[model samples]
Target: MIPRAVSKNGYAVLNAEDPLVYKMKELVDGRVVCFSMDENNPTIKRRAERGRVSCVYENGYVTILKGKWKVRVEKASNIPLTYGGRAEFMIQNVLAATLACFVHGISIEDIRVGLTTFNAGTAQTPGRLNFIEVGSCTVLMDYAHNPAGFSGLVNFISKLPNKYRTVVINVPGDRRNDDIREMGEIAGNNFDRIVIRAGHYLRGRDASDIAALIQEGINRTGKEPQVRIIPESRDAIQHAIKYARKGELVVTLADIVPDDISHVQEIRDQILKKQQATEV
Candidate 1:
C-alpha cells in the first residue's frame, strides 16, 4: 500500500516511495487552472454539469469531488512543512554553504587566525547586535521601531559598559498618533533624552502634527528628558550628538523612504564633516 501525503495548496501524492517523488524531491510544483473572483469558469461549470471532478480553491486549498469520492480541501498546512519553514531552511542552507566555502576554499594560514576576529566581525552586522564608538559614547543603529524592537534596543544598550544615559529617537512613520504616543511612553521610561522627529509619512499626514502627536504622548508619560522638536532630521541628529556626553548612547530611528524623496546621505555626510571640523 502506498502512503498518501497532502498539501494545503491542493496537491496530493500517493506513495512516498514513488519514482515521481524521488525525481522531484527538491522541487515544489503546482498549477492554477482558473482564477475567478465572482463567477466560476466555464470549464469548471462544464465539469460540474458532467459530474466529473469538481474543485474549488479557497483558503489556500482546493476542495475536490469525484463521483462518490470526495476529497476535503488540502492546503499548504496539510503538507509536512509550511512555506515559512521551507524559506527558513533555504536561508539556513545558504548560510551553511557560504561558511563551508570560506572554511574549505580559503587558506588563512598567514595572519594569526584568532577566534576573537570572527567573533568581532560577526557582531558588527547591521540589524544585528552592533555598536559604533563615537568619541566616548557608543551609538547603536538597529531596525527596531515597534514596541518589541524599542524594548530590545533599550535593554541591550542598558547592559553595555559604562552606559549612563540612553537617548532614543523614535519616528515610526506608519504608526497612528496613539501608537506613536505609546512608543513615546515606552521611550520615556527608558531613555534620558527622547527626541521625536517626523519620519516617512507616505500617507500625506502633516509631519508637524505627527511630531506633536509624539510630544503629546511624552507629555502624558510625565517623564521629562530634554525632549526637543527639530523638524529638520539632520539638525535633530546634530542636537542629539552635541548633547551626548561620555557613557551615553544616541539611537536614531530610520524608516524606508519613497523613491521620489531625497536620500538622507547628503545630510549624514554634512553632519560627519561638521563633527570632524568641530573636533579639530
Candidate 2:
C-alpha cells in the first residue's frame, strides 16, 4: 500500500533490517531511503557502497549516512522516548521517523531539538511508558496490546535492575483470544507477579472470560508466576502498587491512559501524605 502511493520522484523510506520491507523496494518506482539498527546491514552496506542515504544506529547514536558522509542526528541514550536507548523498538521508530523527515527536507538541527525535547510522559504520549513513583516502588503505564508491542515491553522490563516485577495487564477484549493468551504467556514468563484486569470496553466478551483466557495462557507457560484477577482497572492498579516490594516495579498495560496515570498519581500522593504524617 505504501509503495502504491509513492511517485517516481518521491523517496520511499524503508527498514533495511526487515527483509520483507526491504523487498518492497523492488515494487517502488521511486528512490528508496532506508534505516537500520545494524550499520553493516547488507542493504545499508550496498547503499553506502553506492553513496546513497540511510539512517542507522552507530556507536550509541542515531547516525545518517549520505553517500560517504556520516551525519549524527542525536544520541538514542539522550532521547527520553527510547528510555535511555534500552527500548530498541523506540529507537527503530525514531530512526524511521528521522529518515522520513529528512526525505522531506526536515533539518538535522530541528530533528535534534525534537528528539531531545520529546518524551514518553503522560503530558506527551499518555499511557505510553508513563512512570510514577509511589512509596518504594515505581509504576509504569503503557498501552501495549499486541504481541510485538508486548515483546518490546518484555525486553524493556528485563533490562531493569533485578527487582521484583509486577504487571497489571488489561488487554482489549476486541483482540483475538490467541493474542490475549499470548500476552498473558509473555507476562507470566517474565514478571514475578501478574494481575489481569478488565479493559475499558469488553466488546462482546465477558470480563471473567477474558481473565480466564489469560489464565489459560499463564497455565500453558511452565514458569509459574503469582497471578491475580482484578476485573476493574483502578482496582488492578491499586493491587499492583499495594503489593509492590521495596525498590520494585509495578507495570500496567493501560487501556485508559490519563485516567490510569492519575489513579496511580493519587496513590503516590496518598503515600506521600502518610509518610508526612508519620514524620510529624
> Highest lDDT: which candidate?
2
lDDT of 1: 0.48
Clashing pairs in 2: 51-67
Give one digit per residue, the lDDT tens place, for model 1 in 1-280. Answer: 1112323343322112224533342343431122221115454454446654434433443334334444433342332222222222222222222222232333322111321133211133333333455555655555566665676556555555555565545455577667777677777877788766665543667777777767777778777878877766556656776678876777766543221012223434555788899999
Residue pairs of candidate 1 with colliding backbone atoms: 7-75, 8-75, 8-76, 9-75, 9-76
For all candidates in order, the CA lDDT equals 0.48, 0.89
Candidate 2 stretches with Cα past 4 Å from truth are: 1-12, 22-32, 49-51
The 10-residue segment of model 1 with minimum total lDDT is: 30-39
How many residue pairs clash per model? 5, 1
lDDT of 1 at 239: 72
- Residue 35 in model 2: shift from native, Å? 1.5
- Measured against the true structure, the TM-scores of the candidates, in listed sequence, are 0.49, 0.89
